[model samples]
Target chain A: MSTLISLIVSGCATGAIYALVAIGFTLLWQTSQTINFAQGEFVMLPAFFMLAGMNMGMPFWLAILVGTAISVAILGAAFKRALVDPMLRHGALPLAIATMALSIMMKEGVKEFYGAEAQPFPSLIPAIDLHFLGATISTQSLGLLAVGVAAVLALQYLLNSTSVGRQMQATAQNPNVARILGIPVERMVMYSFIINAILVSVASVLVTPLYLAKFSSGETLGLAAFIAAIVGGFNQVRGAILGGILLGITDNLAATYISTQYRSAVPLALLIAVILFRPQGLLGTAEERTV
Target chain B: MSITRKVSRLAVLTLAAGFMAAPVLAQPIHLEDVAELSGGGATVGTNFKNGADLAIAEINAKGGILGHKIEITHADSQSNPGVARALVQKALDNNPYVLLGPGYSGSVKVTESLAAKAGIANIMGGEAAELTQTGNEYVFRTSFGQQSTMPKVARYIAEEIKAKTVAVVWVNNDFGKGGRDVINAEFAKRGIKVVADLSTEAGQVDFAADVLKVKNAAPDAVFVYLNEDESARALKELKRQGVTVPLIGETTLTGQKVIDLAGGAAEGALAHVGLTTDAPIPAVQEFRKNFAAKYNYVPDHNGIKGYLAIYVIKAVTEKMGKVDPANFAKTLHGMTIRAKDEPGILMDVTYDEHGDIDRQGFLVEVKDGKQVVKTILPKMVP
Candidate 1:
């Protein structure tokens, strides 16, 4: 049916954004064995920064690139000084708290600078619809899906083929062994942070055009990403994508067939059900603990 | 004896001078704005603050209330009900003469009772119908309640738009649910059958499925009572699905954010709002210009409602001098504040004991990303 096709297209568009943010979560968790609560804030910073550039009369593409670059640079530096250094010296708790504080600071800072208006991002796609297979979909939706898939594919390739990818996997699997083998564990960790920042920023750019760019958007997106991460298996890249798409589809279908008031609740309910049934998640591997 | 008498006379003169200066030593009239300044509803709160600030500045520029300069104290509610209560209490402790608001209806409802107990008059701008019916004497709203506008909105869609079958989609929250109930009731009264009555959660980002159901219903029109963000997303998604039925709803659709988020897709979407800046009233026009100049943005109903609330206070204060909390209850009942050249989105506001406004509603259509007036419904004074 036309309704089904449209729902699928919207689901994919929304899922793509979730997948992008979820990949950042998975990458950081895999490399550092710690979650970066500030991941969503990284996404928001670029979007807001892009807004600032646009407000200053810069072109959209220029603004996006500048915003992405600034976010990556700041996040990279902050992770090195605040997260990596502190965790290496003390423990992971401090790093977690540091990221949380950074998230709060970034959220408030953006609000102060941006004046809390839900400004619209410039649409890259034309306001026209394409009818394919009995379903109508906007150019924005198609563009988001394409961009999301490409980012994931590009990330997958980088992690699989490149020397840096091998080093990252080596560091994640056995940091002590990799460090002994001269894999530059610290550098790998820092690279992971940079990549995390870049991935989140890319997601921000893609999603901002669809949703109104507001200060609190990070919170909602962060929650969705976290959910997607859990659903996909925390450290698995492909799992995250699968989880995001599933969540998006389920959300849309539930809103249509069931009660619309319970639309947001569907994902949480499914997450609970999934965790209870499959403790390791859809793609998560079981880990053995040392005595 | 003569020297002692002269010293006594000088002491008497100094005492007289000190007594005269005491009246001039009065502190400025402080107004406290307790609203969500941070978190989810910060945008709405900021709009409220901007409007209140404009009015306060203008009033102070012309020499503040009763010749005392106006001072404003703001507390961020953070969109939490508990925090809202704490903020209102904090504002009261700061010794403000009047309380402006906690903007959200749920928050306002919580603070209304507290304000009543404290004998502090609240100049509310929230439009929840239940807020006025709580029988809180000190609570007053300048904007018409959702109940007041429901019948008019329904009638406009049914009669003017000539839409027979209509679908309803609203948020589960009090604001949306209440509006939905009123609209449904009005439709029932007019013997119109609602094809689909759907409810969605607040802050929902995806509405494809919800739109699909309405599309399946094949309604001539759809009514949505959703927040600006959700409404924008829903509108965009609906358009993406090719569901092009005439959409109508509450003032939430009038927000600039909705238009911005939906872009060109929002064109032709009709909404029932109270007034617009283009109203041919000099005072409203001046207010609009002044507000736009100060904030560098067009004032929406959120701002206009707050501005009008202050003007209402000014009107009542001018007529009744130094407002007595005890008499405040009676003074507000059936009170008529004429718009009088004020370009309010709603021309004139009249309130009864229940704090509901008896004002006309304006049906506006989003044309070229702006809210253009389609038709103005005559005042339905209750």
Candidate 2:
């Protein structure tokens, strides 16, 4: 019982990290039909930026702030204006291709400049373990869980209650009609990109202590979240959140109960099953072609 | 033809033959190094390159190898086996006398046969046990194979710690998997039970699930065998989980790079190292100082492997009394190079017919961010 509880607790913590990144994926897919393939690399870069800032005598939180600011200015606003706008003009496929190229560039560029070593980052929470309900949980895990849940709730509120979000939803549903209704469709996409950046930045800071800041770390980190978003539902935020948690727990349980060698295989098996049986995902509704 | 033109053509022909025949008159030795200078294996490759370059600088200053200044052409493998094979082909195209490189075992497995076919010696830093098992005579290792290293570690766990149950955490790659298999066999032979065996991905970030599983197992000790960065993350996660079991591992687990990344978590971890900068020998201390001075970072086991590859070429050539590429592998087989004779070799090393190496090693414990030697295991032969 204790072992099961420990696995669930740790797995959920891992899932929360993945969910934070999946939100960005779901948001972009909904707003502009854009899939940022560089999502994982984006998370990795800002952590290094924060490390550079800390090296230059800034506190950890201040370094993170500076890093987040730079990401907003460049990866968010400037990226949309320069590359995303031009690429999306052709279609989402072109934007996806562009983001894939951007991922490689970010990986290689960081490897060239920052050196290919894992730099240790300061942990956000203390390294204290507390026992609760017959299970051992680290303070760091609890801290990260709280932050991730809080961020998700805040994002959910923003999308459900705010006028900007309503307009964004209007643009997502029918960009032509939203523009006709004076919704500023371009600005809605811009807001989606900015929000994606902020979410990844938060995710980056939360996970860097465990992953450390390495150039190749993003490859797996991004891939895991992408799977979560797809398995949960590409079009719905709640589906993505559930998908992340489900994959996380299943992964741990598989490792513990099944063969360790086949632990990764089990989640992949689930992914294939979902794709085959329910392409619309667990919580998603089947959509009809309107053409 | 005019008599003057005929005589000039004759003179030019004779001069060209002389230039080809008297190649020994040239002051430089042509060598090629293809290594993983960027990507996943970048840290290993960079350290190896720096170590090789340092040895070259020192040797050139001391009147060169057999009176020929060593000149090495370095290429990047990018950590991909295919890229490494392509680079090896390119290096062989130059018809280099020796090939050095590709610290990655997968790269070495693909590239070593090329050098063997070309009759050029390849000295690499790959630690996978199966790398040299394919009967590739031209490939030589600067570190011990898992086959050689695991038995010693197994003996330690059974006798020293006397642990009946053990847990093994390994990266699911050629290097880690190879080591894990060897250690498992060793443990089985020694009648030790493997309670939990956790396999991880190469660049996996979260170790919470892995750690929790290990904690649930509640083994007497844990064996970690992963790449440098992943090892650090596992250590950090293990510390955070407050697992009080002693950690034991091979080279990468307690490496200087891992220590730097794991911060305080690496302390008290024990590892069996084939080559470490922390050896008590004066020559090793000097290597540590020179490497730190040159690269401004403490050298890891891979660096020592790289430095020795260059020194081995010199030692073998000098002993053979000629720079003979065709006879290089044959000469190295069943040959022993003594540290007393050539201090650059660092330790007395012998190479068998299969290209495997035997030399002194150390069991060290990480103390205060340093690998403090616990005991020096004597060379396998003497």
Candidate 3:
């Protein structure tokens, strides 16, 4: 039981991180009708930026803010504006390919500058383990969980209460109708990119202490979160969160109980099952199309 | 007029033939080195290049190999197996007398056969167990084989540390898994209980769950076989979980990058250091000083192995008086050289039947941010 409890605590901590990444995928899909395949790179790049900023003698928290702001304001917004938005007009396929290219370019470019070794990120929180309910949890894990949950709640509040959120939702539902209603659909899409970048930055910064920042760090993460987005509900923000958490928990449980050698297979199996049985995902409604 | 013209034409033809023959007779010994300088394996590749460059410089200064100046042509594998293969093809086309690196196991494995077929002596630093099993005479290693390093590590864990039980955690890859198997076999021989056996995928960052599992097992000590990044992350996680079990790391932990990445968490971490930077031995101290003076940085195990590769090649080739690939293989296989016989950071360097080294590695402990050699193990038998 103690072992099970440990697994759950760690699993949930990782799940929270996955949830944030999934939210990045879901937010972009909802507003822009295109998935940013480079969502993971956005998460990885900011950690590198944060490290660089800290190395430059900036305060830790201030470095994080500056790094995250660059990822959102400059990297994310400029990328979407210059490349993604233009390609998106042609179709989702073009946009996706472009995002993948961006992902590769971003990873290789960082690798070229930083070298291929994993650079250690300074721990934002002190290394303290708290034992509760027969489980030992690190302070970093607890902090990540708290931050992730808060971000999710804040996102919910934004979507449910804010005028911009409603406008974003209107544009997502029908761009033509939303444009007729003077929603500025293009701006909503741009905002979606910026918002996703912020979420990605937060997720990456939180996890870097655990993983260490590296060129390949974003590859597995991006793929896993993309799968979570599909499994939860491709177009639903809340579903993506749930999907990410579920995948994380399942992966940890499988590693603990089944076999670490086969743990990767578990999430992939879940993805296949979800695609076959519920193509629209567990929480997603099937799209109604008129022939 | 016709006889005189014929004699002039014969003279011209003789001069042209002599000119062509002169270049071939004076052709210098060409060595090819390809390593992952641009991609994932760049850390090891960079060190390998530095060490190789230093060794080549020293050898040339003393007097070129057999009075023929040795020249090295290098290529970047980009840490990709496909790129490694292409580079091997390129090197073979150049028809170098010898080849030096291409570090990662996968890259070495992909190109080993090509080197064997081409009959080029390709000295590599990859430690995967299967690398020497292919019966490729052209393939030689300057580093420990996976099988060679683990037995000493297991002995250190069991006899020296006096750990009754050990938990094994290794990366789920050819190199890591091979080391794990050797550790298990060695532990079983010593009657130490193999309490927990765990594996993690390559490039894993989060070790909370994995470390917790090992903690739950309650082993006296933990043996880890992983790459630089994973080793650092695992060490940090172990510290975070308050698992104070003595963590015995493989040679990968001996690298400077691992210590730097793990920081204070790596204190008291014991590892089988291939070449200790702080060895009191004059040769090791000299190597450390020379490398630092040249590169403006401390040399790691990877760098030392690169230096050893060139040193060994030079030692064997000088005795031959002529650089020939087939004769070089025979010479490397037949000879057993002591630490005094050849100038290297290792003790006794000998190639076994499988082309693996028989040198015994030193056990080192991390003390005050330095790798301090504790003791050298017994000479390993072939």
Candidate 4:
């Protein structure tokens, strides 16, 4: 049915966004054994910066590029140095609480500066509607899908082919061993944070037009993406992508068939089911701890 | 001369000086604005303050009420109910003649009781129907309540649009749920069947499923009880799903944010509004011009109500000559100022016994990228 197809298309779009967030979670957790709870804010704040750049008379593309670059290079590095690296030594709970505090600060900071008006981001792609397989797709949705898949492919290529990517992987697998092998483990962890920032920023740029760049945009987006990461397999890259897509589709299908009143509960239900049935997730490897 | 004679002379000189400097000694009439300045509701709170500020500035420029300068002090509520109560207490400590706003209905409901207990009149645009019905004599709403606005929407849908079956999708919140209850009750009275009633959580972004549900029901029209953000997203989803049926939303849909966020999809979407700025009324025209000049942006319904709240207070107090809290409340209740009589208000404002405004609700549709008046319903005074 057209309804089913429509739900699938929208589900895919939403899923792609969640996948980016899940990847951010997986990247940092793998490299540094830390979770950035402010991952959603990472997506949200950059869209505002991009808009700020555009408002300052920069062309749209240039602003987006510069905004994304700055977010990745400067803000990401500063966040790791100030919050993550400093508090990470205190333990996971402290770093998580710090990230939560960071999220609140980012939200309030943007709100104070930009005001609470839900400013719409201009569509990166044309608004032309393309219909295929009984579903209508906007060019913007297509852009999101393209970017999501391309980022995933590029990340996979880097992890497998490049020397630096292998070094980073080796550091994530066993930091002590990688350090003994002369690989810079700390630098890899920092690189992971930078990459995390870039992934979420890309998601923000692609999705901000559909949902305007506003203060509270991060709350639901971050929560849902965090849920997706947990449900998919927090440690596996492909699992995070699969988790995002599945959560998105499940949300839409449940909303369509069951009830909108209970749609919000579906993601949590999925999380619970995954936790009960398979503690390590569908694609996650169970870690063997040596005492 | 004796010491008593000198003291008497000093007392007489002081008394004479006090009498001579009476104009300078008189206290300025102060109104306190308790607003959500730094939180979720700050967008409207700040705009509402700006509107009130404009009115205050104009009033002062014309020598103020009863030759007394009007001063307004703003206390940020932070959009929390507890904070709103604390701000009202702080405002009361300063002994303001009137308490202005706390943006949303929840905060208004919370602080109105405190305002009443302190004998300070509260003027706000919080449209919750029960705000006045709680026997809080100090609370007066400048905006139309759901009881007044929703019934007219029902009548418009049934009588004018001739929609037999209506589908309802509302955000799951106080405002949206409150709107839903009223719309259902009003529709039941008019004998229109509500086919599907769906509600999504407050911050929900994806409406594809909700829209598809409406599409399946195939109602003659869809009525959305949602805020500006949710309304924009839902309307867009409705369009993409190719459901061409008429989409009517609550008054919040008339906001410019809906138009800006929804873009082309917002076209032809009808909404209930208190008054149209383009209604060929000089007062509205003047307000539009002055607001744009002052704030560098067009004023919405919230801003207009905020602007009018101050003027209503001024008009009432000016007639009474002195600012007495008890007298002010009584005077406002007894007053019946229509659009034709008042230069500030665009709609007829007659406060009922509960202090809810008895006014006509205007129906507007987005036409050619702007809100164009579709029709005006006759006033149904409650």
Candidate 5:
């Protein structure tokens, strides 16, 4: 049916967005065991920065470049040095709590500086439609899907096939072993943070078209990414993608067939079911702990 | 000179000076604006304040209402009910003659009782039907209530568009919930079958499935009752799915802001609105220009609400020949102020005893990212 096709097509597109944010969360958790609680804020801040740049008379592309440049410095080195490095000694829980504080600060900071009007996109993607089986899909949604998947694929290539990828994996598996093998563990961890920042900036751009630049958008995205990370195991690249697609599809299908009020309930129930039945996520591997 | 004579003369001088020097009549008429400034309802509250400010500036420049300058103080409600209560209580202590706003319906619902108890008129921007239903005589609305507009919408669907079946998609909030209840009641009265009834959350991002449901149900028309941004998102989704059925809603659907946000998705979306800046009338066009000049952005319905409320205060107090806080509410009830009598009201309006407003409304469709008025509905009262 056309309804089924529309549900799947749109679901995959939305899933692609959630997957992008979920993978960024996975990378931080894997590389340094650092939980960046302010992931949502990181996602929201770049759009405002781009807005600021445009307001300052920069072209749209230049504004994005400016936003990326600032995000690279602030979200990467400054974030690790200020919040993660000093607090990693305390434990992951404290770092998470700290990120929670950072989240509130960034949320308020954005509101105080930029007024709460929903900033629309600069018509980056042409408004055109592609139809199939009596189901219509916009070129914008398809573009977002393509960009999201391509970003994931490119990240996968860097992680699985490059020397830096091997070193990063070594650091994630065992920092002491990586250090013994003459790989700079700290530097690999920094690379992961930098990559995390870049990924989030990309997400902010993709989401702004459909979602608009909003202050509370981060909170919703932060929650969605967390849900996707748990549903897909934190360990596998494709697992995050699978989890995002399932989440998006289930959300749409549930709203279609079930009560719309209960749309969110079904995904949360799936999360609980996943936790109870498969402790290690749908695609995540269980660790063998040695006493 | 006699000591008694000197003392009596000094006392007489003191009494005369006291009588002539201070009457407190020259003091400014105080009005407090308790609004949502920093939370989800910021856009609504901020625009309301800006509109209020413009009216105050205009009135003050022209020597004010009743020759006493109207001064307003703005308090941020933070979009929370509890915070709004505290701020209303604080404003009451200052003893304002009028309370201007808390544009959000929920905030207005909580704070209206406080002003009602204080016997001060609470002129507000909330359009929730239940707000005036609570028998609060002190509460006055600057916008259209659902009870006033929904029947007209149902009639339009039943008569003009001649739709037999309808699909209702509404936000699950106080305002949207209230609208849904009224429109459903109206639909039932008209024998229109509701094929699909969908409830969406306040900040829901995607409406793909919801739109699909509407498409699959093959309703003759769809009603989208949602908040501003959510309405745009829904419009976008509805466009993406290529749903061809006529889209109908209240002012929430075809506002200037929604048209801009939804872009071309808003074309042909019809709505009946009590106040719109896009009306071809010169008065409203002048107001739109002034508001944009002041705020650097086009004002929404909330701005119109706040602007008219201040003019209402001026009209009433001037009619009474004095600022009587106790009699302000009684005077506004069942009062008709014509547009020719007071140009600041922007349109002729009549107030019922229950504090609901009836004014000229527009049935418009979004054309080229603007509302083009298809028809003008006359006021309920002649």
Candidate 6:
């Protein structure tokens, strides 16, 4: 029972990061109808940037902020010029190919700069355990859970209450129709890309303390998030969070009860089951397309 | 064509021919080295390269191996088995007489089989027990097998530290699993209770969950059996959480990265190490001084293992007075070299039919962020 609870707490902490990355995926897919395969690389880039900043003696929080800003700016420009502009002029495949090439180049570039060694990231929170019920949880885990919840709530507010949020929704629903109604559809999509990059970057910074900063971490975490998005229902934000948490819980439970060796198999199994049974996902509405 | 143009063409052809023929005149004996030179295992491979280079330089300076200057071609396998096989094939096409190796057990297993089929002598630096059991005859190792070291490490922890209840945490790979099994068997023989046994992936960074589990179990000491990065992360996490049990385990703990990452947390950690460049042996000291002069860094066990492996090969070859592959194997199995005056090249060198080394490990403890050799065990002549 203690093991179960501990796993759940830790899983939720990791799941929160996954959910954030998945939301980035959903945002891009919703607006542009194209997935940024380089989304993971975008997430990873900020972590390394923050690490580089910290190595240069900058404060952790300052480093993270700078890293996030840099990644957002680079990702925004790249998406606009390299992906969006080309796709608008040509077609979707060119953007897809460009993103794929970007992903490879990003991975190699980071590896070359970082020298393929896992560097320890300074912890934001003190590493101490708080006993709850029978399970002991670390401050980092608690911090992760808080971050995940905060990101979700903040994103919900941004999408519903804010002007940009309404603009993004309008653009995502029907760019042609929204533009006909005088909405800046192209600007909204660009804003969505920038927002997605920031969200992923924030998630990367939060998780770096736990996993340490490494070049390939973004890809590994991004893969998990991608699965969570599909399992939850691609474009549903609430479902993405729910799916990520559920998958994290399933992974931990499988590792404890079934086999530690096959812990990674949990997300795939859940994805298949979700796809088979609830094609629309737990939180996704029936009107939403099952893509 | 004009006579002047023809004469100019002949002059250019003659210069190009001379440049091409210069390489053929020397015909350097190219020896291929495949090891993990990057990622988590880079230190191991880098050390091996240092030692191999030192030996190659020494051989060339003294007169060359078999009247041909020694040249080494290196490839990084990154501790991947598939990559190791590809590297071996790449090296074989270059027609090297000897292949130095794939540093990890998994890579060695793949490379050794390939080398055996190709009728090439492989000097492996990895200490996996199964590598010795291959019975391939052509595969030679200067390092003691994991089977030999595992029991010794377990005994050291149980008896020296007086830790009766222990937890075992290891990577879910062949090397970790193998070491864990041996340690478990050894612990059981001594009637010690294993409080918890856990496994994590090789490249995993976050070990807080695993560390929490081990802490909750409340073992006296934690036997961490993973690679350098993971082990260091585990140690740091455990320290941060105030879990202060002594860490005891494999040679991976001796890596500089582990020390750098763990900092003060690694001070009391006890680990197994074959020989450092600072060993009391005179030859080892000489090799150390020379290596430091050449590379500007102290050599680790990986470098020592690689250097000693070639030294063993050279000694055996000298004894047989021939470079025949079969003779080389026979001499290796029957050979014993004493670092007698130096006392540290290896406590003593001997080998069995399984290619198991007769060398023993030194129990080293981290003192002031450096490995201080605590006790040395004499070679167990099997």
The candidate 6 chain A region of ten consecutive residues with least summed lDDT is A282-291
> Which 10 consecutive residues of model 1 chain A have the lowest summed lDDT?
A282-291
**Global CA lDDT computed for model 6:** 0.75
**B1-382 in candidate 6: lDDT tens per residue?**
8999999999999999999976444556667999887655666777787788888788789776555677888898866788888999899787776789778887887778888877777888777777878678878786777788888888887788888899999888777787888889999998888998888887665555677678778998888888877878788777755688788877778555577667677888888876665456667678878888997666667888878766676666556665655456666776676666223344567777767777756777888888777887777753
- Top-scoring candidate (lDDT): 5
Tens-place lDDT per residue, model 3, B1-382, is: 6999999999999999999876454466788999877655777887888888888888788766776677887788977889999998999889888888888887898899998888888899888888998888878888788777777788888888899998899988666777888889999999899888999987676686788889989999999888787888888888877889898987777567788889877888888866666766777788878999997778778888888888888778876877777788878885677677666534567787678887666788887877878887655664
CAPRI docking class of candidate 2: medium
Ranking by DockQ: 1, 5, 4, 2, 3, 6
Candidate that scores best on TM-score: 1
lDDT of 4 by residue, B208-295 (tens): 8888788889999999877667788988888887889888876777567678788888999888888556555677888889988998
Candidate 3 lDDT over A120-176, as tens digits, reads 787777768898888888888888878877887887778779999989988888999
List model 2 lDDT by residue over A203-287, tens digit each.
8888888777888778877877888887888887777778888888888888778866777787789888988988877766565
Candidates, DockQ: 0.72, 0.55, 0.48, 0.64, 0.66, 0.31
Residue B297 local lDDT, model 4: 75
Task: Put down candidate 6 lDDT per residue, A1-291, tens digits, no spaces.
Answer: 766777788678667767777787777766666667777777778888888888899998999888888887888756676667767556556776778788878877887787555666777777677888766677777776777667768877888899888888888887889999888987888887788778877777767766656666666677788788777777777667887788777776776667666776767888888888887777766554565
What tens-digit string does per-residue lDDT give for candidate 4 at A1-291? 887888888798889888877888877776677888888888898899899999999999999898988898755789888888789779788999999999999988988788766788987878777888878787777777678778878887777789988998898788889999999888988888888888877888887887788887888888888888887787777677788888999999999888889999988999899988887776777765200
What are the per-residue Cα lDDT tens digits for candidate 5 across B27-52? 79999999877666777787888889
Query: Poorest 10 consecutive residues of model 6 chain B by lDDT?
Result: B338-347
**Which of the CAPRI classes, incorrect, acceptable, medium or high, describes model 4?**
medium
State the lDDT of candidate 1 residue by residue for B1-382, as single tens digits: 6999999999999999999976575467778888777776676677788888887787778876666677788788887778999888888777666788888887897888877777778887677888988778788886778878888888887787788788998888767777888899999888778999998876677777788888889998899888777888888877777778888877878666678678877888888887566455576678778888998988777788777766666666655676444565567678887766333323677777787777766778898888887776767763
Best by DockQ: 1
| lDDT tens digits by residue: candidate 2, B143-252 | 89899999999999999989899999998878888999999999999999999888997666667778888887899999999888888889988987788888999988
What TM-score goes with each of the models? Answer: 0.94, 0.92, 0.89, 0.92, 0.92, 0.84
Interface root-mean-square deviation, candidate 4:
2.1
Relative to the true structure, how large is the alpha-carbon lDDT of every model?
0.78, 0.86, 0.81, 0.81, 0.87, 0.75
In model 1, the runs with Cα more than 4 Å from the true position are A88-90, A288-291, B1-23, B323-326, B340-347
